[model samples]
Target: MIARWFRLAAVAVASLALLARPAAAQQILRDAETEAFMADMSAPLVQAAGMEPRNVQVLVINDPDINAFVAGGQYVWVHSGLIAAADNMNQVQGVVAHELGHIEGGHVIRYGEGMKEATGITLLSLVLGAAAIAAGGAEAGMGILGMGQQAAMGKFLAFSRAQESSADLAGARYLSKAGVSGKGSLEFFKKLQNQEYRLAIPQDDSYGRTHPLSGERIQVLREVYTVDPAWDKPVDPKLEARFERIKAKLVGFVSEPAQTLLKYPESDRSIPAHYARAYAWHKSAYPDKALAEVDALLAAAPHDPYFLELKGQVLLESGKPADAIPPLREAVQLTNQPLIATLLGHALIATENDANFAEAEKVLRNAIARDRENPFAWYQLGVVYEHRGDLPRAALATAERYSMMGQDQMALRSADAAMQGLKPGTVDYLRAQDIAMVSRAAVEQKRKKK
Candidate 1:
């Protein structure tokens, strides 16, 4: 039961980069691109909302169509297509402002409420259903709608036009109040209107599925912007560059392998073009070609960890775990990331067998500690613990993971293992009592510590 509907922001590039950095892991340039752009565009609007810039995180989905949404109370998700297609900073700001309107006006919470009433599941369960979908999809690497919730696949996308319109009205006002160009919101909707007509031929909910009925909405935006004049801020070229690079990188990951390989770079006939080709060929499983391409990239920028990490991932995926070792080790030594540590743990388990079990176990434990939110890490930890003959501990870890993930059946199995291992009147049960107390406190603790 994969939920494909929880798409509100760009969640894949960072997740992939975090998972794959063995020899030369590169930070996702796309999310960083969106965040940097949003940071500049959000100033006026956030100032108006009376919120801090750091409290907000802007991310781009690898998706190429126009769309935006908010997750929970933070992190606005914009499609990279929106970034590529935007004419200026004002248009982008308008999109951000619209989503901000949802958060500021509690439209996101409303959607959750509607869905809960519709599906009879808690908000946290909905998020877990989405994460389960993501982990399952990881078998195919990365592509379009990676963050799309598993629940969406179950035909459960629930956002009414009223909610969409409310968000839009609130968005326009937020833009005006924040002194951003409110008129740009109208212009943004107008483009979507034109896109709607162009889409009348196919009619498959390209951008207007949740944000429905663009024609009338476009008029409403126009009226609002005309009446209120907000600051007309100019677009930054650097932001545009980041946007283009994000598309290029996403295209690197999701485009048809052969098609991507055929795209040649005009800037540098040697390095960048080859780097692009390497991505396609390696992902397509042509190891010799990937090796040859990486050799060329290394010749141009020998110390670049990004290229090195890519080459390492290719090697590991190609059934050459030994070949993947040196570069991945080098990458870890360079970055000190728990992400690389986890990848290395996997490599050791798959390739080194029993020889490196001790090392893999230790590294993965550290990785889980650093990022418990990664369900994959928990899954891997269970595997490691099971291998060590600690079946009861393995079951507990897996059950805890499933509990966190909202997979009650799987969690129940794991929890049963730990409970079976327990004695009636002992410190083990007492320790469990302490954990429950802490969890109760966690639910009641609303404010973050300073």
Candidate 2:
């Protein structure tokens, strides 16, 4: 199921931007469940590349383009569209493995260096355009739109054809070492090639425009993989099923309800299809139907954490926080995922039951310890503290929440309030001081820009 946190974070511009390239023209999606799923699927490839799985961050970009790229250190940004468009697990895993190849080869640093020598018109205009897109998206695109198609493509295209071929070989090796077939990577490239052919007339210069592609790249990939013994290995059915469910979950939440229904109709009795329809029904205001569908799913796999989470989320959002507690608790127990634990904490807080207040505080604190970047968990911690009448601690938690949301001014205020009552040099006091310092810097930076 699509985590409610992502839906909430989507509308929050400042918070969302901070999680991504800060001031770059990229849209970074924040979804705990989706990210965890991607990480699980890509762990083997990352390990095979001799990289730490924890160090490699798999970020989702909220774009409809069929592209994946690596930027900065240990960051792989996959477009939501690519995931939704992928036919199976291997296709998506191939993309992940390919991007990992770029990282392992240190292509990002080399490309950045190459960009330094690109044509001035392309360089300056693209930088400014990216900033504009980062700052205001469509509203800011107006100024750079006139820069024209040439400048829209970033300087990273300066990557040599040799680099592309090298990445193809490296990616195939990683896949082979990880015991995964390389066929998906080949298929993905051909998909791009087919797209290039269809748009051969107008040339939609969106994604993959920077990457050098040629007939030889495909031939090289085919030649490299065809000889490997693992080339024809079948994709694991369980892994494939997980990918299908995730793709369906994303479509159910992001696509129009009518469209979702059309894609997964009543006759489609698969778990993923039902999962899709449950979300569609929930989104379309058919609450009873949504619950019914979820209940049916539970009948088949009652202990499934994700299914339990879906039930909990549906109930909680539909104004039954008290009712939402049991399944959320069960889900948390089964999965031990901090995301689900955080959701359960939210449900506990929403109930406003005096008896649940302490439990909520404990739950939120544990969640924050494990997933500190989650703004909602911090916010709920503040809510719990406030309910307990612990004003100073409440303010500190509020400050942390505001800091995560990129509201530095509010963070400063809350931190200052926290400092007034928090004990000197203690953990809470030190945290508040850190918040004050960071917020002061952020506020000053904004003022200077204006």
Candidate 3:
């Protein structure tokens, strides 16, 4: 799931409940390879937007629908379906640049305020409607959207035509400045044009409904590409290779083993083919076959951290935590990636050795420092603290986990317990106090509403 709370200063944590709520529960997908590829595509667009790449996160939602949107100005949620639908990395990058246009143009805030005023529904509700659309509850979401439209002049929360035009123009500029083509944006709109005619359900046409492709928008993009110098820029061969692997991996993990095998027959000896087969074998519960395929991958790219990480994941999931450690440790050292570090910590904790437990605590703490928004890291920290008989620390970690997840009541209860065990004025104690104060206020506010 997407981490509901964005990491800010500690002082900002207490104000979370007072901030806007999400439209629906977030279902975020975390994968090292996929995320890395997304980051690669996003970096140029983010830079072209005059924004810090670190400040903009590209999050993948697990839903299988062609949808993407910017929420909270910090996150861009792209459905896995969009990636699956894309024919090239540039197509995906075009979408990212467009969303960045929304962020850079400050359209989200302005459009949100306008929609709230026009529709008389909180922006959160509209977001929930979008989530419903993404989750295949199109009929339900359209009903909600229809209510908003009927309330006003059928505007609902969709972006105004002027705003869409501005975003399209900005997106083209960003892509051009980044030495990427506007062709992808044009092609995507062409694809949407086809969908607009073919798709029956309003909300089911996610990109069409949200993006609202127009002849003018398509014409404008076509003009931009024709005049822009970057239009003929060759696709980055390395990026294409990575995108292919990512698609292959996604198919292997998300598709049935039979389908995966059929797609990647034994005669296909390419790296991506082998990678897909490995995951397919693993998912089919044939660890030996999986290991053999992974070994082939390791032999080809001996130092590839993802391959090492995959080996560790396969071994760990197959109930060999001890054997998992060596590869996981190597992976962490090679990459120092937060996700891999967390996985290594999980393997360490699972081993249940005293020395391994202590090491796990250190690794988890470091991972949490870098990735504070990851509740899994905090939960693992709690597990480590509990193993070491540190109840106070464990309680505080649990409070943090619940707090980030927006579970104010549970956060308050855990924070209360933590505060009793911890000394006053310490960092943990102060954090616990903040959690308790904010969570208690939220609970009381909820009660008053009831």
C-alpha local distance difference test of each model: 0.61, 0.77, 0.78
Give me the displacement of residue 158 in model 3, in angstroms.
Answer: 7.6
TM-score of each: 0.60, 0.83, 0.84
lDDT of 2 by residue, 1-450 (tens): 010001112121211111223213655666556777888899999999999999998888776777777756887888788888888889888888877887899875675454444344544655666788888685566456444233423333333344555777788889999989888877877777777678672344333333455344577778878888889899988777788888888888878999999999999989989899999999998878999889988999988888899999999989999999999999888877888888899999889789988888888888888889887888888888888789999999889989978899999999999999999999999999999999999999999999
- Ranking of predictions according to lDDT: 3, 2, 1
lDDT winner between 1 and 3, please give it.
3
Model 3, residue 29: displacement in angstroms?
A: 0.9
Residue 63 of model 2, lDDT score: 69
Stronger candidate by lDDT (1 vs 2): 2
Cα RMSD, each candidate: 14.6, 8.8, 9.4
RMSD of 1: 14.6
Model 1: how far residue 230 lies from native, Å: 9.9
Off by over 4 Å in 3: 1-24, 116-151, 155-159, 200-210, 214-216
Candidate 3 TM-score, true structure as reference:
0.84
Backbone clashes, candidate 2: 0
77: Cα error in model 2, Å: 2.3
What overall lDDT, based on C-alpha atoms, would model 2 receive against the true structure?
0.77
Q: Name the lDDT of candidate 1.
A: 0.61
